[model samples]
Target: MEERVKIIEERSLSEGWFNLKEVIYDYTWFNGRVQRQSREVAKKGNYAGILLYNKEKRTVILTRQFRMPSYLNDTSDGFIVEACAGMLDDDAPEECAKREALEETGFKVKNIEKAFEAYTSPGTLSELAHLYVGAYEDDMKVSKGGGADEDEDIEVLEISFTQALEMIKTGEIKDAKTIMLLQYAQINELLN
Candidate 1:
């Protein structure tokens, strides 16, 4: 068996709206006998969230916003097309999803359903995403989307099930989370 690097020390690199940490890994994996005895060790985190669906309208709710990462990387839709999701700040996945939906869409979620939970980028970062679908009620749209403090310029989109599928096929919906939500809806017959 290959030896692995053991974390001996971890320091809070930064914490504010988000948290980052610096860690020390004992490089035993490299020091062990034979070059074959080596393995990588690291610390990571995940982005947990949920996806909302509206069975009554046969529509799915998505958010369109400028993504700095996508902009920098030259990815299409620097204005991203994604499911309503947010970072899980010490809360249960469903609770976080509900809070995010209300915050991002200014709409209330009813009969929220759990779709799935996944790692956005497991090999590199520890960003666990919780997927969810809630029945969307448009009659309850209150306030304008999201909070201003986060500097979030969000636009809400409501599309019929077929339209959503077309967007996905044409790569119009490029965000992974959004694609997953659409898939869940399709598989469950929440969408035609």
Candidate 2:
């Protein structure tokens, strides 16, 4: 096998974003170099969270909201079912996640467990997800959910483990970050 990438030049497209020029080496056929064939988006920053609550009950919380991308993609209500998450801007991953959990769903997490670091779309978008599994006893701490003024129309949904599972199976919870965290929680039996 030959390496498909051999960088010739790199250019910044935006802050924390870039484009790369490379060669496409094929072992079987031929080794050809392509010059700036296309834009390879390289993003540098955390852009997500996947929080888990009620570990004993095997349930997790998620959000239901109108997403413009989904709307353009033909979602019935343009709504995306996802875990509480947001972009991090010069904040610690854990703190950013905790703040997002509170602001998105109103759950003041007592503790947040780091799960894994992953990329949602590596081919184009460099959006990395700083995954976390957090727990909090549903109490008076979270009566006022988040409705931030960042081009977001979020609706919180505290669902049971069973409901979360069903939603996952039915394509209701389709976000990559949410799915990644949920899969870990389910496999580890930590979504109580």
Task: Write candidate 1's Cα lDDT for 1-192 as tens digits.
Answer: 554656667677666544556655656444463322222323444455556666777777788888877888865648887887776667777787888888888887656878888765555455677788887677767767664346888898877888888998998888888888788888888854
Q: What is the lDDT of candidate 2?
A: 0.73
Full-model lDDT for every candidate: 0.72, 0.73
Where in model 1 is the C-alpha error above 4 Å? 1-5, 8-46, 148-150
C-alpha TM-score for every candidate? 0.77, 0.78
Candidate 2 lDDT trough over 10 residues, lowest sum: 20-29
- lDDT tens readout by residue for model 2, 1-192: 566555555555455233333323323335464434535465555665856568666567788888776788865577888888877888888888888887888778867789999877878666678899887676725656755667667888778877887887998888888888778888877864
Error of 2 at 13 (Å): 6.8
Among all windows of 10 consecutive residues in model 1, the one with the lowest summed lDDT is 33-42
Measured with C-alpha atoms, the lDDT of residue 45 in candidate 1 is: 42
